[model samples]
Target: MGRHSRKGAEAIRPDAAAADPAGRPDVPRPSGGRRRRQGPVPPADGYTPFQDAPQVRGGHPEQREPGGGWGTGPQPRHETTGGQQRSYAYGSAPGAPDQDAAREQAVARQVSAQQAAQHAADGRTARQPAADPGAMPGPRREFVDAFDADPPTPVGTPEARSGAGAAGPPVEPEEAPDGEPAERREAKGGKGRTFTGIAAAAVTTVLAVVVAGQVAEDSAGRGAVARAAGVDRDGSEGASRSDARPTPEHAVTRAPEVKPLSYGEKMAQPYPIAADLKATGKFEAVPGLAKAPGKGQKYRYRIDVEKGLSLDAGLFAEAVQKTLNDDRSWAHNGAMTFERISSGSPDFVITLASPGTTGEWCAKSGLDTTIDNVSCDSAATDRVMINAYRWAQGSATFGPKLLLPYRQMLINHEVGHRLGYNHVSCRTPGALAPVMQQQTKSLDIDGIKCKPNPWVHPGS
Candidate 1:
């Protein structure tokens, strides 16, 4: 019984305070047997509202809503000091979820406007220019950085700067500043452009070869033209200096014993004489002289010995034959014969007489004579008339002991006369006396002897 009674009384102990719908207890009621109604309590932080409120973050309660141009909401407060209950009604439109979203949009707009103003003050546009599709962004950045940096000393003029471009931030492009991509540029035309040193040089070489060929052809054509016009490149003269007749002044006394040589080797070989007859214009070879004769009679050589002459007749004949044979020039053309007569049918003839009687005999017979000797002509035929009478015995010039060389010279001189070479005075200064000169008596010049026997071969 006692446990049941305590349960009823304690279980029925009046609610200490009535709870509101929020599950919080209501304020205490007054004591006097009459219950007192409680008013709204302050927030836990003990905040209060000012009596003459400065302002509300969002204007009026009716306007604080979406699209209502609202700003920040009012500060939180309580009704503690009997000031009118500061009801900060963060309002919402009929379809609005809350007032916070509208406030956020308004703040974003303010920030945008402030940025625009700042950009304008800095003398820059709010929007940047569009980027180019084909430009070098790296070069652009480099250009910008360089532009902002301190300027270098002026290179030229202010007009130069005006012509130059202005600088700014980099604007990247899809392509380079060279106008096109490397691949595109290469494909533009079928010109086949390529880069190479060796190949280019080869092309240049080919071109050079072509040009040289053209130049050579042109030069050849010009030469043909000149020839057709009768203009000679070797001057207007018909003959070379080598073709002219040479004089003893430039003759070389060569040894007839010089061994034969080939053409090229002979050109290199030295001559035995003191002078180079070829270089001095006195040397000549007459290959045509050995050619077949057009005359009806065969060419022949005759040596006529004067009767009672001191020269050995056989030696004379043999010497002449040997000299001619050794030279090969004169021997090729004719046959030689020895004779003794003042007149005969021979092609050539010689006469031997006493030195004392030589001039008398020629004078009596009506013949031409030299200072030391005489030469008689036989009206019958052309002849080599040698008078050995006036020569001193055993002398190089002439003697009873007839020198072979002297006789050869005489024969050559007379034969030359027969061949149309007249007696011309020797002109070589300090030279050997002419083979034609009367060395036995003539002393026209000092320190000079008779000309070499071969001097007439090249036309003395």
Candidate 2:
């Protein structure tokens, strides 16, 4: 039995030497191809099993089984070394270190710190904290202080640098004379203010030219307006006459020759009177003269009839007085006043005469009465003559229905002539003829037809 046991021990020795390159006599050998349970063994001097070593990653020691293998060892406990507490995980070796991994980690950390410093200098990020807390922050703080103290440079411009190996004090950039930004001057090609001033001056000049043109046009317009309002006395266009003129003669001694007229010829006629009227060719004044009721220039007038006239003088005078005193008359609104005077030398005379006598009297006043039976307000004779022929026979232009209104119009027309009004034509067709229009001659004149109107104020 002793010899057999010695041979079995000697036979397992080679297997154990083959399993472990380093000679270890404490390792139990397996019997019948099964592993054996053994008691915990102390590490050899300067050597430890791979399963008992510590593991490290990124400078921090990790709690892991050594060599990634499981072990049933005594639980580790806290220990104090160099006054610092250290903890070891279960199944870790007590005296083994991975020097190559630690050295490689140290080299990687150094390369990372150098890259971080370079990034900080290039302004990519803020400076990183040192791996060792006790390391001084002097160089980083100094760089930050210098950067904060420097004056800010304008964007899009290079920062001003100091000399080769020395850092100088920060300098403030000079301002432009106009207090404008350097970038703004560069953007506008250095002509911003000059261009603005030129544009403003151009706008002012344009406004001045427009204003001058308006003033010139207004001056010319005023001159034209003034000229258009002026009129002359000889029935011709002329300039304004603000000066007074001499009084006209009241009568004329010589009369122009009369051109004979045939019957049925159209003559501009006067107020109509009865056919059986008689005349004596001498004047007799209308009686019962009184001041007319109005508020304007007073004009005393006399109504005269020929001595041989068969007409009722009292009736004629009454009709004339009523017509002139009407509300719509030319004498209304205080424009003028008229009264009949039997004794005094009147302002003018209204005479009812025969056709032959009317021609002689109108000719003496420089009117062309030879054209036949027409009335006239002659400035030379100061007389408003009503032809008896037209008084008996109304004008061919007016129908019998308009005879009475025509008589009133005749009275207003001759009176208007004496009031310094010249003849005017109708302005609009179908409108009332103005008092100054020669309505008795023809209501349709200059291609404008008008209705007969006896009163000057048609609305009134």
Model 2 poorest 10 in a row by lDDT: 156-165
Candidate 1 TM-score versus the reference? 0.27
lDDT of 1 by residue, 219-325 (tens): 99998877776668975734444556675765868768967554333222222311111122111111111222322234444454444333345445544444444
Residue 45, model 2, lDDT? 42
- Model 2 stretches with alpha carbons more than 4 Å out: 1-279
Error of 2 at 419 (Å): 1.0
Error of 1 at 123 (Å): 99
lDDT of 2 by residue, 1-460 (tens): 0001223343333346656778654354333432343333333243333443332335333343222221211223233322222333343333333122332333354345444444444452245454466432233334443432313432221112112112321111122334554234333422333344345544655777677789989988876765676643344667445336544577445687886643222122233555444455788788887678887788888988877665557766766776777778877777877788887788889887876677778888788754746788767896799876665566666665556666777788888788888988888999988888876678898889988787888797
Report lDDT per candidate.
0.38, 0.57
Candidate 1 lDDT score relative to the true structure: 0.38
